[model samples]
Target chain A: MSIALYFFAGLSAAAALGVLLFRQVLYAALSLLACLLSLAGLYIVMQAEYIAVTQIIIYAGGILVIILFGIMITSRLAGKPMQVSTQYPVIGSLLALLIFCALVLSQPAVTSHTSDFSTNHWQRAGRWLMTEYALAFETTGVLLLICLIGAAVTAIYQRES
Target chain B: MSPVLLYLSFLLFALGVSVVLTKRNAIVVLLGIELILSAAILNAIHFNQQFPDRMDGQLFALFIIVIAVCEAVVGMSIIIRVYRYYQTAVPDQINELNER
Candidate 1:
């Protein structure tokens, strides 16, 4: 299990790096899909089956599709690989590296305590979400509705000359 | 296989960010942002497993997914409108609003 956990973590990190280094938009999008799917797999490895499924459905299935469709609709595909300006490359890379190092250093040392990854815990999560977190859940729905209306208005409203 | 998988995910995330930062295409930038958000979600779930008593990480991941969808929709709409007015989707080319 430890080996599997480490493997998933490394895979996720690599995909994240791909996201940061890829030059082409389409390839980058594909890489993003790969990253999201891998994250879902990591969720499964972490014993969060519900999160894994949601990650797959909402991110890999839904959001990725919407982004791909947007790219298709925009028709801004590049003919050549985009170039990064060299003026601040060293500073930017150093900053990113520093942040990554900080994240790694901040992680708590792994302990020997092993959790019993079972179905009961999942049920507990469901109950808690429905009861304790219900308000937040409801608010999310409202937020989605508002986003939909706002998007429609923004897309449809024409500017007057 | 596990290490390989984790490395792969990291690579994807880095590539996505690069696209978002370097690409002139607005939609591509949005895609990159989505990739970054998913990376954060993955990290949360990983930590959640290590501490099962709290389901906060998973819940947060769920919320992040919802927000990502909302951002994509609204972002795409904004991009469409920008394209309609500017006749181009390249960020560099849409500088009419910039003050000289």
Candidate 2:
């Protein structure tokens, strides 16, 4: 289990690096897909069964598709591979490294690492969502509806104006 | 386990920040945002494992997933509209509306 955990974590980090380094838009998007899948694997190792599946379905499956569409529609077919412009590469990376140092220095110490990846959380999560997080669930539904309507309106509104 | 996972999350978050700052394409920028959110979500899951019975961390992660979805949808739509209007997906090139 520990080995699987480390493997997925390493895979995720590597794929994320690919996303960072890839200059081509399609390649970066594909790298993001790999990163997300490896993240799902990490979630599984961490006993987050629901999140693992959600990460795969929603992030990799759904959001990625939308991003692909955006890429396709926006890009011109001028016989050129779609490449994203890199701006302030050195400064951005330096700032990111500074932020990483801060995060590491401020990280909470890990005292007890639990190996409790055995219990099934599907039923428990469902119960809590319906009861304790009931308001949150309903609000999410409303937010999704609003997002659905809003995205449509915003996207099409510009065409007519 | 906990320390490794937390460090991994931090690494991803930093990478995401760099992606957002360095990339010019709207889709790639959005992807960077997704990476940032996912990193934070991973942290929530890490804590969820710590206090399994409380279930707060997991629940928060779930809500964040929903929020991320909404953000992607809205952001994509805005990107689409911007592309339609300016005929370019690079945010830096959109200078008409900028306060000069």
Candidate 3:
């Protein structure tokens, strides 16, 4: 399981990098799909099957399709690849490195938990969602609804204009 | 899993950031942003396994996914508008409003 997890992680990371490096928009989008799928795999490895499935369905299936549709409608394919400005590459890379280092160094080492995967994991999560964390869960749902409305309005308003 | 996978995830994330910062195309920059978000999600899940008592990490990942969806929708719409106005999606060429 650990080996598989590592493999999937590496695969995901590579695909993510590919998203950045690919010149074609479609290719970059496809690479994002790969990365998302691998993330789902990682979720499963963490014993979060629910999250894994949601990640696949929501991100890889729904959101990615939306992005691809946007690219299709916008006709970015016909345009030539853009050139990078030579002025800031070195500085940008250095800043990114510094941030990455800071993040890694600042994170405390995770303490290990010995609980094995059991059927009650979902039950516990459900209980928490309904009882203790119900408000937060409902708030997230409301946020999603707002975002959906906002996206729809943006799309429709643009079409009408 | 071994530490290599964790390192790889970090590397991918760094590459994505570089792409977003260096790329001149709006579409490509969005893709890079997506990549960076996924990397963060991956790390969260990885750490979640190390401490299974709390489902907070997984929940956070879920929220990130939702947020990413919203971001893509809005961002793509903006990109489309930019394309319509400028006839190009290149970041450098779309700077007409910023030019003095």
- C-alpha RMSD of each candidate structure in angstroms: 3.9, 1.7, 3.0
Which lDDT tens digits does candidate 1 get at residues B1-100? Answer: 2233333335445545554555556766787678667767765655565565778878888888899889989988888888878867677888777998
User: What ranking emerges by DockQ with the best candidate at the front?
Assistant: 2, 3, 1
In model 2, where do residues sit more than 4 Å from their true spots? A112-118, A157-161, B97-100
What local lDDT score does residue B1 receive in model 3, on the 0 to 100 scale?
A: 40
Report the number of clashing residue pairs per model: 46, 0, 0
Could you say which candidate leads in TM-score? 2
**Which digits, one per residue and each the tens of the lDDT, describe model 2 over residues B1-100?**
6788888999999999999999989899999999999899998988777665767887898889889999999999999898888899999899997899
Off by over 4 Å in 3: A76-88, A101-107, A157-161, B2-6, B98-100
Residue A28 in candidate 1, Cα distance off native in Å: 0.8
TM-score of chain A of each: 0.82, 0.93, 0.83
Residue pairs in steric clash, candidate 3?
none
What TM-score is obtained for chain B in each of the predicted models? Answer: 0.83, 0.93, 0.89
I-RMSD for candidate 1: 4.1
Please give the lDDT score for candidate 1: 0.68
What is candidate 3's lDDT per residue for A30-104, written digit by digit as tens? 888998898788777767787889888988898788778766766644566433233277877887787678666
Return the lDDT, model 3, position A127: 72
Deviation from native of the Cα of residue A101 in model 1, angstroms: 2.3
RMSD score of candidate 3 (Å): 3.0
